[model samples]
Target: MKKLVKLMVFIIALYIFLEINNQWLVVTEHVLESEKIPSSFNNYRITQVTDLHDATFGDNQQKLIEKVRATNPDAIFITGDLIDSNRYDLENSLHAVEAFVKIADVYYVLGNHEVAINKMDEIYIALIELGVHVLPNESLVLERDGERLAIVGIEDPLMGMETEEMLNIALANVPDDMFTLLLSHRPERFDTYVAKDVDLVFSGHAHGGQVRLPFIGGLVAPGQGMFPKYTAGTFTENDTTMVVSRGLGNSIVPYRLFNLPEIVVMELKSK
Candidate 1:
């Protein structure tokens, strides 16, 4: 009987600890090197913000912006789910969005929440006005020195069209000699991006499986069931590298256990 009581107390303590840890924000840094990188863009930093879900770290997301500003990023990439669908509040998210725009060039892709909330048109229009490169099956070119790189964004599959079809359109105009960066919401479609010969891809939506178990990785994710692959970290296939952020917010899972919010920073290095 005493052992049973002690076990119960331990479980309760563990739950409390996990809840507190989930609120803590963290920054993850990585360096991506490739011969394809241009010298002019060497050491170029990119801050990735994903799955905000209307969660504010501080007033108007001032704390979050401060963290990003310290990175001195050349650009900010928002992979998706900037707002929550069930809550359906844009004003809160827009404040963070507005702050992000002031930092650097921002590129965004659509997430499932954006479509589920049914505010796609309104959100896209507002973002476009902010000079954000909100790509929906589209591509944009950034030039450094005499070299150019392609940054493409794909819409979420919930938008009523096949993702592969949209991918074809986005990559159609990319030049053969340029380095390509694809912004996709789902990491599960990594093979599709690899098949297209994309140089690198940034993705979120798995939320690090919401509850990671050390070496076991994420417990479950939306699209990928139990023990889903590609939950976080860098994965390679052929010539493409996919960096999946654990993400900054949660949706299906009420609280993340062992999975904390993180902002991923990538520095491009020339090999």
Candidate 2:
């Protein structure tokens, strides 16, 4: 009985520690050897945030913003799942958008949750109104220091009606000799992008398995299901690279174990 009581106390203490320190901003840097990137565009900083899910950001967000500001990111990208639920609440989404707007030039794509909540239109408009560039199956070119980089955002295939056609259009304008960054919510569609020879893809739909196992990896992932392929972190296929964020908040299940919430900062380097 005494041993049992001691074990229980140990478990409780461990849980508290994980929850309080769950907020971690992971910074990952990668370099792509593409003919398109201008020689001067070698050290571009791209900050990425995914799966906020309307949970309390705690100090993670503020610290992330400060870090990005310090890095002087060339641009910011949010993959999806900004809200935790389908039901729209103005306060939470708005607050998230406002906070990101103050940090850097923001661009976004919708996640499955955004569609499930049936508030994509309103959320899209709200984000744009707040000076965020909403890229729904579209592409934009950023010119700095007389050099150009192609940034493309694709809609979730599950929700967007003309996802395939839109992807074609978005890629049509990308020059053969330019570095291309594709923003997608689901990492499963990597094959499609690889066929098009995209340089890098960013995604966040899997919450790093939600409940990760010690050495076995993620136990469950939404959409992808058990033993999900792209739960969190970085994956590469052929020459195309994908970074799946563990995400910043929880949904469906309110608690997280092993998998802590994260905001990803990726610096693009030239090789």
TM-score of each: 0.93, 0.87
lDDT of 1 by residue, 3-56 (tens): 999999999998888766566788899899999988888898989999988877
Top lDDT: which candidate number? 1
Q: Which window of ten consecutive residues has the lowest lDDT sum in model 1? A: 18-27
- Considering only N, C-alpha and C atoms within 3 Å, which residue pairs clash in candidate 1? none
What candidate 2 gets wrong by more than 4 Å, as runs, is 1-15, 24-35, 59-64, 67-72, 160-163
lDDT, candidate 2, equals: 0.77
RMSD of every candidate to native, in Å, equals: 2.7, 2.8
List where candidate 1 sits over 4 angstroms from the true fold: 1-19
lDDT of each: 0.88, 0.77
